[model samples]
Target: MIKGNLAGRMGRMGRMAGDSGPERVLVAASFANRVGNGLFNAASALYFTLVVGLPAAQVGAALTVAGVIGLFAGVPGGHLADRRGARPVMMAALAVQAVSMAALVLVESWAALTVVATVDQIAAGAGGAAWGALVVRVGGERPAVFRAKLRTFVNLGVVLGTVGAGLALAADTRGAYVVLILGNAASFALCAVLLLLLPRYPVLEAPPRRRRWPVVADRPFLAFTALYGAMGLQYPVVSLLLPIWISGHTEAPRWTVAALFAVNSLFCVLMQTGIGSRIESLHDGGLAFRTAGLLFLVSCPMMALAAYTPVWAAAGLVLAAVFVHSLGEVWESSAAFALGFGLAPDHAQGQYQGVFGLGFSAGQALAPAILTTVVLGLGATGWLLLAVLFAALGAVGPSLARWGARTRPQPAVAAEATG
Candidate 1:
């Protein structure tokens, strides 16, 4: 009987991975989209500097400006998705991305680059909001689990795309770069086409006499966003701060940075679905967030200690710390999927998701400067402080999630019955 139960559970998991036709289509679309993103991420800087003859500083400045401008697009785009329908908005955004990527091949000047980049960023922000809403509709009962499955495929696609990028980077010619850019553009077009295969979702109706900007007015959700944003510092800690620390401060080889990244990615691909499957409720999510925070506490100190160790010891310590950090990342991400989806009203998922994304994006924008000043500047003391901050944020997650849940709008029937 135990063996039979285990086999049945495995079968259920298999079904969950691609339960519906729309879910499978969405997964394919997400994979195709991320593959292009991976290629662009690996090669865009080199292409702009070497092939297009643009200065590095100008490129950075343009990208920063574009990121800042793009932040505003999510809210309005999500609102539109709520009103018009997520599927149509998502297709429109993908179409815009395709056009913007094609335009990048023509960019020769900073002005041209900035304009095209800004448009691309805006489209990306809008599309992200629509995607979140669509996921809610397509995922049926277990959206978070489905999202986890999608992330696994997304990582695989990126790995594949990076391999393609490696060939382009090796060629190191204008033609190769142009081909890379066009490939990304084509991917976006293809993703849009794939999205068309999914069934159309009907527009969700808002509550009668609802606030004009209900998500904006949701203080509990806003508070949760702030905490989530604070915890998001973990991202830059891994990507930006650790590399600098490894190269300049630790006795470890520079190659450790790449190894650590690969470790993190592999962990995500392998473990994300399992972790997400476990966190099925807000309570589970809150606990997972707390667990992530505690893990961060343990890992951060180990990372700090790496700077003081000998070469071999430093490498071992850094590797161990990153392993813990990656586990925390999986837990934290699972918690986010649960809370981000659970706290919002059914009709306004797009708006709520957009607002939630604002916090993450804002944190991302600020993380580089913050990490440089705090962790890099202060050394061991900085790492401890950041760890404490993450723990504190995680510790409060349950209470704040409870608050958000309490504030959620009731169903029309329930409200009418209460009245």
Candidate 2:
């Protein structure tokens, strides 16, 4: 009797743990993926400009090419994710990324870097579609719960990766580039392993012979895509150019930028789930998007003004900007994730995510060149202008919210076939 009682008790505990098993696995895998990518972001510019002796503009140009290519890559990537289920697509893409990262570290030539960047981003685009769609599928109507959990893990990973890179830079580690690349490759492998623990789910495939770009014909959907894309464009300003501005204008240690970013990531990890859930629950997601957008507008000009203020005050401004920007990210991301699945039929989730990727690709691709030119030519004032552009994106969000409210829900099979 005692043996049976103990066995029953243990079984209950096992079920309790297993209930969260898939969600936890997805979150852990996402965390590793973000951490590895964060290292690449932290180190890549220095690797190219200082180590490889390439011009900054040249590096930006390469990213531009990658971004443009991603525009085309999205269709197939999204389609595959929906058609093939998230597991295989994510695993295969991560595998490719692992190979690419390894090559990037070993081959340091400009030719090699360019090739790696191109291939890596293509794989990344595919993986991103799968990841986003999987989040929706796994979380169902509560995408906020999943996204927040994922974001928290993502932030943790970013913190680890950035802090680690800061340490490498401080030590002037000889194999710093190799360390970053190898770390990225390992992270991808970990993502695969973590994903393996999740329950198997079918991929959401689009109908046979469905054409690409037709998604744009859905006006409300297109507006949502554009708004989300604009938000992504602002990320370069936050992550890439903002650091450059800090380095040039202040006596702040280079690692301080990473540190500030780490702080922001930590906060995001803590708050994203709650904030994302709240926003998703709103009857009008656009209102939440607008609030987030306005916050960013208020914050962006402060980034540029930090240069003119007292050094201590400038530091405060940068921190404030980071906080606000992170909030905007949470809002925008929550709406985007929720709508991507909510608006589509089960079968079309893949295409919807893919179509969304096109806008993101365009925005990110243009950001490097545009921000670099603005900072170089006009300095801080240029960034302020960029902020205004971001703020303006809020106007579009309301339309999307209204569209969300008004769009006619299609029959399930037609929704699947159309997607």
Candidate 3:
């Protein structure tokens, strides 16, 4: 009797632990990949300038060119995944990226850097599209839950990788750089192997061959995507703009920047899953997005307050702003995932996700110049303007999502062949 009771208890415990096959593998693989990426990102610029003997400007130019070119490949990548299968496409992309990372050792000049970077960026876009489709396949009906969980783990992995990268930076030798680079390549290889271990799901039936972009035809969905992308400006605001905003504009100490980022990362790791769980349907997701906008509106003006305060007071305000901004980030991410999976047609998931992703790309591309003009160029008034902008966009999200819900296309099946 006791043995049976213990066995039952163990089974229940396992369920509570949330142990599953495919989601586990996917999360583990994502962790490895993110860690590798963090390592590479931490060292790549210094590697290019010091070890590869290229100018910093040349490296930046190479990256910018690669990013721009890769942005256009998302749609084609999705198309390829739809025609083929997500697993195959993902594995192939992983293999290509692994090879690209390994090949970085051979780069010696600006030309070589440009070529290598371009290839790497293209593979990254394809891999990203494939991975999103795979989450849908593996998560079965609740891909957003799986995706949100995956993101949290990814953040944890990046943190660990960043710690490792700090060590590499301290070592700062050509040999050390080579090791980190190769470690990233090896990590991708491991990710590919892990992906193959997961059960492969069947592909959705492809639609009849068409030259036109179906995703483009979905106008309301496109608007939703664009709006979400605009919210993505928060990314640049934290990573790119904030440091400059602090040093150039605010009275906060420069060291507070690191502290602020730490808070953001920690908050995400701790709070994302909790916040993500509440976003289930399109309505819930839209509400979360609206909440995110309100948070942003409050955060920006609070951040503006930092500029007029004393050092400690400014730091306190910035810290508070960071916390508020991070909540919005979680909300935005949760909403995006729900909509990303919920709204996309099953047969055209890859293409839809790719197209939807353009909003993120567009937001990233546009934020720099736009923020520079208002936030930096105009100062406090500009900050207030940015706040209003976020409020307006977020306020409109629910309506746009409702419109999007109406526009979702019926899944187009591969027309059955006549006998």
Candidate 4:
């Protein structure tokens, strides 16, 4: 009876989440891909330092260099998606990543490590571009709903992979590391195979793919991307800044950081898709974004107060802060995905999403330094200012999305321009 009930519930969820044929395929493949990513990231540093015997410093340096080098990958990948279609580009990119990931087991020196890492980084950059293009290709018209479900599944995959990583770490043997690495590579390979099983979207016949960046030419889109990038700072804020502030400046126990992060992650995993599904159109996207800004306004000040509170008070406030912060993130992300996908000309999805990716990427790359300088360098008042900053920036989303609606191309026009 329990098994049947479980199966029945799962079926109902699939229906609600739009897990139709292609959507299910995309979610399955994405879940597989994220599992590999989580496993590799969890093990990569340990694999390099402990198993491969490279110095930890060299590993960090190589990865940093590779990250810098890989920054250029998304734009060209997008153009290729426009020319060759999303599936082929995604499959080829995944194949490259799989090979590169497996090759990590063979690295003995920094030079070799750098080479392999760079190849992997390039593939990752291209793969991310291709992945975005594939989502656009597969989801069609109203993808935010599908994407929300996909993101939720992706988080579940990460949780599963992280558990695998923890078990590997507990085993603490070179052999265990090798298994983890190979297993991650295999997951990537399997995901590519599954992607191959999905329906293909041929490049709609169009004018030669433009070499010029369309996103840059569109001013409102650029502004929106910039603001979206700042909003994305919530990531570093939640992960890095809050933890650092609590440990260094507040009365909260050090372990409290872990507890708070658990809450944040679990909240996101539970609520992200539900929030993401609500963004049906441009106006809905605007409403979500605006709503996100208001939530940020609430959360930011709560976090700021943690600096001086008693242990019990601090712990409770931080929980409240992150709960609000997590919701803001859901709204911001759902809105951004809708806007990012919605604002572009259809033929240029690869390029557009690539550029749109810049917003989030910039936040990831820059937020640590920016947040650290603000929260620590400037002191408590900095928190108040940050609250205002986040709120103000978020407030801009609805209007910007509204503006995008005015200039966004008609579906027929976008289709023909590509033709």
Highest-lDDT candidate: 1
- Per residue, candidate 4 scores C-alpha lDDT tens digits across 1-419 of 99999999999877754556788888888888888777777888998998889999999889878877777788788778877988888888889988988998898999999999899878778778778878877787667787887888887788778778889999999988888888888888988999877887778654466445676788887887788888787788788889988888888888878777777768878998878987857677777888888888888788888887999899888888988998888888898877777777777888877777766676778888888986678877877788788778877777887687767656633542452
Lowest summed lDDT over 10 consecutive residues: which window, candidate 4? 410-419
Clashes of 4: 2
Model 4 vs. true fold: TM? 0.92
In candidate 1, which residue pairs clash?
none
Q: For residues 1-419, what per-residue lDDT tens digits would candidate 3 score against the true structure?
A: 99999999988644422348787888889899989988988899999999888888999899889888878777788878887888888888889889999999999888888888888888888877888888888877677777777788888888888789889999989988998999999889999999988886777785578434677778766877888888788888888777788998778888998998888888898888778876866777778889998999999999888888998899999999999999889998998887777777777788888887666886788889888876788888888888888888889878876776666543311110110
- In candidate 4, stretches whose alpha carbon ends up further than 4 angstroms from where it belongs are 1-7, 207-213, 410-419
TM-score winner between 1 and 2, please give it. 1
TM-score of each: 0.93, 0.82, 0.92, 0.92
Q: What is the lDDT of candidate 2?
A: 0.72
What is the C-alpha lDDT profile of model 1 across 104-208, one tens digit per residue? Answer: 999999999999999999998998898899998998877888888888888888988888999999999889888888889989999999999998788878779
Specify the poorest-scoring 10-residue window by lDDT in model 2: 410-419
Q: Candidate 1: which stretches are off by over 4 Å?
A: 1-16, 410-419
What ranking emerges by lDDT with the best candidate at the front? 1, 3, 4, 2
Best by TM-score: 1
- Report lDDT per candidate: 0.87, 0.72, 0.82, 0.81
The alpha-carbon lDDT assigned to residue 145 of candidate 2 equals 54
Question: Which structure is stronger by TM-score: 1 or 3?
Answer: 1
Task: Tell me the tens digit of each residue's lDDT in model 2 across 160-191.
Answer: 88777777667655488668868989889889
The lowest-lDDT stretch of 10 consecutive residues in candidate 3 is 410-419
